[model samples]
Target: MIRPQWEWALDDVEGRRLSTPVTPVFTAQYDAEQWLGEHWRELAAAGAAQASLLHDGKQAAPGVELRFP
Candidate 1:
């Protein structure tokens, strides 16, 4: 099996690692990034310490992960 281009990951409040993964809601990187910027607060308030929009289930660079509170 292969990973999707865009996927959502959730970490515990103040955690550094992703604790869970849900179905990807976006197919494009741009859309995924936009979605995170738009709905980050809601996700955080709902119990996400840090939310990430994974690109092909990987990070582009070290310390360059797209994480939001």
Candidate 2:
């Protein structure tokens, strides 16, 4: 059986994909979400303007805004 691939697609203010600060790939969606919850602040500070949850190279949910006050 093929396990689902979970990852985050991070974008910049201009909506361009980022190459640095590589995102982690997961076997479960829950683990991917938890990783985001813990590192969102750093991601935002790293110039990530938005984040989208992806499963097997396809969008799995609505994108998240990374702007923090």
Candidate 3:
């Protein structure tokens, strides 16, 4: 089995931590009340609900209304 290694001090290595442009071709938001039930485990395990929903799931509920921006 092959495995990947990450040496923070290595200069010869090409890390996957590089930044890239994110042209959002598709933008949408999920209904939390709907998704929460299905993704309860995921939501609970998420480090940050806002960050997780926006980045991971592309959902953000700022107020009573959800935004896809």
Candidate 4:
């Protein structure tokens, strides 16, 4: 099952939420990294989708997850 993209915090006064896609294209276990990195600049320039890097306080990868507006 696809994970939820949004989570709510108890302290959110206006019910502000934290959201991010739990499954991105790069989550595919193929050559996703190479394809995503190579085309990301053009994709972003074309306003296709929003791309952001993922990190866990240490390492970063070339994988990208796209979110739509």
Candidate 5:
């Protein structure tokens, strides 16, 4: 059985996909979420406006806004 690849699809302010310097892939959903939680601030600074969880290239959850105060 092929394991599901969990990742985050980042988008910019204009809704265009972002090709960030770090493309992290996880083996589980929880890991993906944890990583995003820790790095969202950096992503926001890098011009990511939002992020969506993806499982095997399909959207797994609604987008999370990457707002920096």
Candidate 6:
């Protein structure tokens, strides 16, 4: 059976809370990172200075988990 999968969230640098967006649940880390790599600039423009790939209350993406100021 497939696992519950993973999830990704964007956070405001100064706010440090989940972005107002409906964070998506990712099935794999690669997909999450790929999205962040592409959309991070947009998020940053919208007041989100950090993107997080999380699951089970911990970081799901290796090397880069949370990006904050």
User: What is the lDDT of every predicted structure here?
Assistant: 0.60, 0.94, 0.27, 0.36, 0.91, 0.63
Which 10 successive residues of model 4 have the least lDDT summed? 4-13
Which segments of candidate 3 are over 4 A away from where they belong? 1-31, 48-69
Candidate 5: lDDT over CA atoms? Answer: 0.91
Model 2: residues >4 Å from true position, as ranges? none
Across 1-69, the per-residue lDDT of candidate 4 in tens digits comes to 762222111111232322422224334423444555556545544443443344322124432334334
lDDT of 6 by residue, 1-69 (tens): 766556666666564766466556777767767877776656666666566678755866542334435
User: Which pairs of residues have clashing backbones in candidate 2?
Assistant: none
Q: Rank the candidates by lDDT, best first.
A: 2, 5, 6, 1, 4, 3
**What are the RMSDs of all candidates, in order?**
4.3, 0.8, 15.6, 10.5, 1.0, 3.7
Ranking by TM-score: 2, 5, 6, 1, 4, 3
Which parts of model 1 are misplaced by more than 4 Å?
Answer: 1-4, 14-23, 61-69
Give candidate 6's error at residue 37 in angstroms: 1.0
Which stretch of 10 consecutive residues in model 6 shows the poorest summed lDDT?
Answer: 60-69
**Better model by TM-score, 3 or 5?**
5
Output the number of the TM-score-best candidate.
2
| Collision pairs in model 3 | none
Which 10 consecutive positions of candidate 3 have the poorest summed lDDT? 4-13
- Winner by lDDT: 2
Clashes of 5: 0
TM-score of each: 0.59, 0.93, 0.22, 0.30, 0.93, 0.66
Clashes of each: 0, 0, 0, 0, 0, 0
Regions more than 4 Å wrong, model 6: 2-4, 61-69
Q: Which has the better TM-score: candidate 4, or candidate 6?
A: 6
Error of 2 at 17 (Å): 0.8
